[model samples]
Target chain A: MSEKGLLIVLSGPSGVGKGTVRQKMVESKLFEFQYSVSMTTRKPRPGEVDGEDYYFTTKDKFKEAIANGKMLEHAQYVDNFYGTPLTPVKKMLAEGHDVLLEIEVNGAMKVREKMPDGVFIFLTPPDLMELKDRITKRGTDAAAVIEKRMAQAKVEIMMMENYDYAVVNDKVENAVNRIKDIVSSEHVRVPRVIDNYRKMIKEN
Target chain B: MSEKGLLIVLSGPSGVGKGTVRQKMVESKLFEFQYSVSMTTRKPRPGEVDGEDYYFTTKDKFKEAIANGKMLEHAQYVDNFYGTPLTPVKKMLAEGHDVLLEIEVNGAMKVREKMPDGVFIFLTPPDLMELKDRITKRGTDAAAVIEKRMAQAKVEIMMMENYDYAVVNDKVENAVNRIKDIVSSEHVRVPRVIDNYRKMIKEN
Candidate 1:
């Protein structure tokens, strides 16, 4: 019996290397997952196309989608609304494709509440000192901004309790392999197999 | 921070390829686990060394171990006592090694009750007809004996509800790989990480 595809939510503290790890995992082709296109009210960044990097929408449109229950989960951050659209994810799962939602802590919690069957994974830094160093080495933000982000990291780390699994991004390869292993293993759960067994028994 | 190892118990109907699957899983070496040596009052078969195949014990010694609370779980089958020892498993976990226990359904249930930490895995054949075919092809038993075993198979398959994960043994290699993936994924449990974080917080 073919089981339904999984809904995997990947959440991490900022600069924990989840983006890179996810890229590597997707490259493996071991899983059939759609990388969700988030709907955002913010203008697209340079080289990022609307509906590709994100489904860029006007503030009014974003609000309408939320009101119409078109968004699975949404959160307002930095004065912009960002959310996961329900339609594409639902369509993908129905086609037996797993859906990967690369999101933050707040959005992950919201999705978990809506879909208890979803797999929630938290990507973590190896240690706080390493996390601080990594953020500083990025050189994108000023020292003050880096410090602020590190402080926020502590709060985010605390929220990891809400996740089903935690993988430390010590190395990109290891983290990606770990996530892939989780996806492969979760498919073997009892409910899925038992449902298949029941169906087989009925037919035979 | 290091994570704690899992206690995994695997059981299935006889001739469902449980042993072959488990053997292949151990050969993968992706997981660090000690195969639990059960204490048994039955005489060892040819080429079976004490403590290697099974821990040969006198009925009196088995009773004494039970009285001393040394047995994780025990049962009387065909006038012989068979049980899992508690001490070595605890020692293995304390040393950061996962433990794999292969036991009957009742033994698995009792271990779950006593430890409440072990992971129960139920392995099933692809279909009842295939299960019967495998039993007959093995040719170790007479036709009447094979029929009786097939009857017992149904009873065991019904016990799949007791397991945390149910894997279909359609192919030995696939089942083994799935088991390895499950063990690796379970290593990322929240409690294990939170424990590490708590200790680190205390140290700092």
Candidate 2:
């Protein structure tokens, strides 16, 4: 049987270390996963390459793609549209490359609706105090904005049960290892193997 | 939070190298799980240690234990009653020691029903031919008995999907590692942490 790609959607609160965990996963190179380059109307930061960090786009172009159904899922955040494109993901999957998307809770839900077979993993902070500390330590947002984000975080934390797996970001190594274990363990699930066996038996 | 003991139920078809897997797990000493000694009515083989290999008991005493609810779960096999006792398991759990019980499918089911929180792991032979080769290589069972076991294995194989986790026994090291990862990963499940947090918050 041919190897099939996995569509993994990771969602979490503001500072639960989702990006760090994803970075570790990419460095490990244990699986064939391609990170989805999101299409966003927001301008790229310094040193961030176009089509690598994101597909930097205009508001009209983003809206046009959304209208044409070229985007798998899109959302407006801070006056900018961010979305995952379908064609690239499909092409990667067709070439047997697992795809990973680091998105927010709302975008993850939309992706789940679009691709029912996709896997979802939600990262959570070890504790509320630690979560508050992490958010404050970032020092990018104002106090009011941080409070608003924390309030939103509580709502996001409640949605942990909705994801197929939840990893608490207590430590970077442990969390990354957990994600790696999940990817490996999921590959050997019985249904997938049985399906492969059936196809093999048919070929025989 | 204090470390809690795990009740692990391990079941697999014959020739799946479950015994080897358990031996390696014990060797690793990663988790504090001990092999549970089952009470059996069968006469002990020469050089077998009572209370080490099994708790050799008379048929009447075995039946008495079942009637008195001392036996955790029991089944008749070839006119011998083999069962797990509840007292020692309870004591072990109370003292924070994880216990692993290697039993047949029916026994595993019974334990799962009794202890709804128990972890059930199903080990599988990589394929039918490999299973047959391993069984024959054992050279203990008669041809008729071997055929009977293979037939019985088919029934057990069908029930694998009921298990919480499934590991294929292609390589002993891989199987043991899978079980180890599963045990470690399960302990970090977010709901359990959330429950502990909720309890502390309530107490405060």
Candidate 3:
């Protein structure tokens, strides 16, 4: 009964494995979902495209877009700005394509304010201790940065209230499977499909 | 994240394959769910037990239960009264056992009125033409009865708005799998599991 595509937002605290889980979901190709192009002030981490992967832009330009309300949801992580472009995501959804947005928790909350109908999923680490281990194991952040991230993770984990689903990032494979099920299940959710059936009955 | 049992109500128009689909779901042994014992005024058709399969009762006693608001939902079908006893279902849910109830459309709606939290599923045939064929092929109803059932089917299908999910009974296996996904997906629904996470995070 669902013809229009769904807006699925995946977000979580830093070091919760949201990035790895989202990467696997896209690579699995089990679902027909399009990726949203986001604007970022951070330099590309090798092989990332300018428009396809992210819109690599200056901090001023990113701020301009934010001020103009051109960004759907934006946040600063590790002193670099990242935000999703508003128009493209809407255009994709309007064209009957499901859009998947992998964003930070604050940005996801902003997206929820603008698109309350979107499916918000929170990816959490198995435990706070495990979360701290993952962050420290990354080896790129300094000890102070790691400590800051641990504090932020606790606050964001508490923000699970803003999500529609809480998937534990215990294993990448398991988390993606649960995500796929949620997407498939949402397609058959009564509110999403009942109108088509209502119309079909009248015509039949 | 889900702890309390989910109340799953499966209903559809006559000949829409709700019973067959529900049977497969239960037999699949994929989900941990219990079945509710229904009260039926119809005589047992061999091998059916009074308390196990259905609570065999007279029309007067069934009416008395209905008048007492003991039945969660009840309806008269083909001169037989069929209903679900409320207290038992509630007790099962309280004990953290998911309960699946398969009933006719009218009874399903009545259940919705009382327990809006229940997951309501509407089983549908591939099409109205197919629905008519299924009813006719049963070969038990008279011509007038078939006609009445077909008319009732349209009304029931129109009542699809009252459900949370609609699965097409084109193939029993496919429908059951979709049902399994929905059940798994419901376990992660934010409202159902958010409080649990909130408590976990607070303790951690």
Candidate 4:
């Protein structure tokens, strides 16, 4: 295939259901893409496959991989190293296979540095998405509680500025559908498919 | 709603089903947007009410409006003048209402010069969309036939480079669906929605 694979970087603030939305997208066969398997120091949870769910690794090996710059984006959560192997992801993309990377905000920022052209999507929190409704309900909520949420949403909005598209995680299925449309729309974008069309012209 | 509306401009080469796709999108109620009424000098057909379909006007009046620069984009087709009124479309967009404008490539280019921020979608021909398939069938058709089609497709692709998205008109329903997705995805784009979000933070 002459078409190059797009690196879809999906990230958002914590508790925005990034993992759940990603899982639903894969389950629904929303878009055809290979997952950039994350290598984690934590032991596999029940029913989690070795290479499918995650590449289970030891702390020392993970540290070595990080030291060697093999990870595309790596981070520690609860004393466990979680990262995406850079080479495998690059290999899949080169073969015209889109790679879906679900990383935390910090890790996504790192990926942005390495892959500036990637399609970066930010998932917005449901509460933050309903700011208009929340404004209408100002009389119901405590002033302190409302102020705290508004402050948190402000920070998330700042993080979202780094992304190209933002999807509200009000519903997982709806979010996946939006992403499916985005991927389809991206495929036909003149900038992405122009080269492939150009190749066809040249060959003939 | 505090959100500003988008100007969705759909155009393509002749015989690319641009009208069919636009009609389908409206029938499906795919996205909430006002239909931009086009002013024309052509006599209304049976059951085609003025203002609903077209604002029927005399040739002299149409020419005077065009001379005054009131038309956003106008074209003369078969001795009849057809053009869009600039004031209404701008009024709708200013009131936070999206407007869909299906125009010819030349008129679209004119609109682009005036409203560069509009979402411009180009409809590609089905034959051109399957350039790969046709490549395999290169031997089946006469060389001249193939060359002619390729030349036409090349012109269309060149026109497409001016658009933001290219949807192949293989199926009218599929094209409408893709457009629906694009509109939904476009709504949450950070650049479009960030100001509304910024307002929320400042208000509290």
Steric clashes per prediction = 0, 0, 0, 0
DockQ versus reference, model 2: 0.30
Give the per-residue lDDT of model 3 (tens digit) for B85-139: 9999999998889999998888888889999889898988878889888878889
- Fnat per model, in the order shown: 0.66, 0.15, 0.74, 0.59
Stretches off by above 4 angstroms in model 3 are A59-64, A77-80, A139-147, B59-64, B67-69
Error at A73, model 4, angstroms: 1.3
Tens digits of per-residue lDDT, candidate 1, A1-204, equal 666789999989888987887788788776678888999999888999988899999999999999999999999988999899999988887787899998888889989888888889999988888988898888889988988988788888888888989898899888888888898888887765677776655554
Question: Worst lDDT window (10 residues) for model 1 chain A?
Answer: A195-204
lDDT of each: 0.85, 0.81, 0.88, 0.83
Candidate no. 4 TM-score: 0.82
> lDDT winner among the candidates?
3
List model 2 lDDT by residue over A153-201, tens digit each.
8778777666777787899888778877776666655554556544433
**Top candidate (TM-score):** 1
The 10-residue segment of model 3 chain A with minimum total lDDT is A195-204
- On the 0 to 100 scale, the lDDT of residue A107 in model 3 is 86
Write candidate 2's Cα lDDT for B102-184 as tens digits.
88899999988888777788898877677878899999989998888888777777777667777878888888888877776
What's every prediction's RMSD, in angstroms?
Answer: 1.9, 2.9, 2.4, 5.7
In model 4, the runs with Cα more than 4 Å from the true position are A43-48, A128-153, A200-204, B45-47, B78-80, B128-153
